[model samples]
Target: MVIGRADLHTHTTASDGMQQPRENVRMAKEAGLAAVAITDHDTVEGIAEAMEAGEEFGITVVPGVEISTSAGGRDVHILGYYTNWQSDDWRGRLGSLTEVRDNRNLMIIEKLRSLGIPISLDEVLDEARKQGKDRGTIGRPHMASLLVAKGIVDTMQEAFDRYLAAGAAAYVNPPRLNPFEAVEWIRQAGGTSVIAHPGLYGDDDLVEEIIRSGAEGIEVFHSDHGTDDEVRYERLARQYGLIVTGGSDYHGERQGVVFHGTIGSRTVDAGVLKQLNPASR
Candidate 1:
């Protein structure tokens, strides 16, 4: 089989991404992608819509989710691919995570309010509705859009840089699973767990620990990594015998970075997908 051009990581309205799933797929096809995955942060609500859109656009859609977990008191993201989205295990885990995320978002909102920014949950929800195109989950991107709408920031990056980023005034820590526990959960769900954007985390030892925990892959290529970093991650993946994956980590216009198919880019090889057997999940 021909190895199609694929981006295994991306987002949609289901999480912090700006576009709806259909729009993401349409853009991916226009960008000459043969396949794409809607690995939305902490949610799989958009995966079905993405798959439907991919069928029409002739881009194979991989079901995926970017799970937020904690390790050493820091947040780590794990990308789970090819799991049964509707399974009881998946639902249970997602429900628990959703509660954690919702609580975290509320805390962020309260922090912003205390800072005198005063963004209401209703306002955030309305902003999400405006961008959601009536599908998928609403998230931080929507809140950022509300900030933009209120003239708080010129762009999403500016919003994050000034407030939402770590160490920023509006930043708040969210509850999450530790890396080992996250890997175990993914394995239990019959999915492959991968460390997302290892370069950004800036800890090689942590990456090794994650691999030891049960992570089968590493996102060696990503929009966040520079050329040297990509090479380093590639070398690490090879050294650890890990499956390598890459993607744009597209969040739509909410992020000012390169488009969905534009960064540390390499297509997902067919062999890699074959290795992610759904039957194991």
Candidate 2:
């Protein structure tokens, strides 16, 4: 494919991202990226459409998923690449994770109500469905959008800062899979697992723990990562013999604000995609 730059992490309407899966591909193509990954939260529903878009745009789409987990009293995300996405078992397990996301959304909505922000789950779903993504994963970003719509928060960042981010008012951590389990799940499903955005976890020790526990790669360059974070994680990747990956973590724009970054803002060489593929590895 003569691949060049590849953004290895991004969300779509299949999760909380404002754009559709095809639209993300189009953006990647417009950004002059050779490849992009659709690592939607707890779901692979966007992969098919993204692949089709890739064909249309002459860009490569790496079928991927971002599995959300809790570890060390913090939210962690595991990115799976080149998974057997069509497997019934893989889809079934992801279905269970979606249930967890569903419960967490409800809990956040209830907490928002307690804080005098009268938002309903149905309202959030309706807003999400505005893009005809009714079956996609519902996340805090979805709820945060509703908060902005209701004038409860001035912006999505404010909504997250005041209510959705960890330790915020509406924040709720339900018992869920840990990073190790997530790694194993990806392995069992014939995919390589990568520790995503380790800088966001704020626990290098635990991030290393996951690396030693079987993560095959580390996201060294992420939209939210600083230069120091990139250097540190790049060093760790070399030390542990793990594949080094990077991505924009793009979630599209909300209220004229880009969530993490634009597509192609942070990317690794497209050659890294081969390392992320289990078969090639």
Candidate 3:
């Protein structure tokens, strides 16, 4: 069997990413990647279009989702691969999560307004629609774009630092699934679950707890992970007999800066894609 390179994490307009689903596939092909995963935040709506583009571009498109979960009062993201995304149950459960996300957005907007930022949810929705398809999920990135456009912030990072990021002034963490529950959800949906960007959580103990809770994989190489993080998680994956994975977590360029990193910037052998599927395991 021949193995190629695969960037197993990316986003599109179906979520907060600036690019369309087909555009991400095109970028992956242009980058010489044999495969890419459309792992949008809390939604698998982009997978259909990406899979179509993959056939046209001769690249493998992994159906994935970056599920937003909260654990120990931290924003922990769980990545699901090869999921039954077409299932009505899966879509309905995701809809509940979206409701939580929508409420969080409104609370953030209210907080920002109280802080005298002069923003509204309608403006954020409009910005989201303008940047991507109207069906895309409206997220903090869209709100940040509006903040920058309104001259409230010079860049998206500034907006995140000031308002969107955890511990920021306008930040809000609504009740959501724990990492363990997310892992089980992925299994119940006939997919594999991996701990995403573990280095960002600032709590290796909780990460280890999740690993012990039956997480099948660990994202050892990510756009934001440093050498130490890579080494640490690689060791953890080995210790726990977990599948090792890597990706760029590409979210597309915003304000002259690429969010996280560009596609194919960090990738692993395409063999990992097979390892990411429950059937293969």
**RMSD of candidates 1 onward, in order:** 2.3, 1.0, 0.9
Model 3 regions more than 4 Å off: none
Return the TM-score for candidate 3, rounded to 2 decimals. Answer: 0.98
Q: Lowest lDDT 10-mer window, candidate 3? A: 129-138
Candidate 1 lDDT over 1-281, as tens digits, reads 32667788988777777777888889878877777888987778898888899889887788889988877666788999987887877968887887887888888899888988979988888888776546545566667778889998898777777878777788877657787887888888888888998987868899899998779999987877889988898998899888898888887764455434441154566456766656632
Worst 10 residues of 1 by lDDT: 255-264
Clashes of 2: 0
Q: Compared with the true structure, what per-residue lDDT tens digits does model 3 show for residues 1-281?
A: 22799998999998889899999999999999999999998898999999999999999999999999999898999999999999999988888888888999999999999999999888998888878656757889999999999999999999999999999999999998888999999999999999999999999999999999989999999999999999999999999999999999998888789989999999999998778876676
**Whose TM-score is higher: candidate 1's or candidate 2's?**
2
The number of clashing residue pairs in each candidate reads: 3, 0, 0
Task: Tell me the deviation in Å of residue 110 in model 3.
Answer: 0.4
Decide which is better by TM-score, 1 or 3. Answer: 3
RMSD of 2: 1.0
lDDT of each: 0.79, 0.92, 0.92
Candidate 2 residue spans exceeding 4 A from truth: none
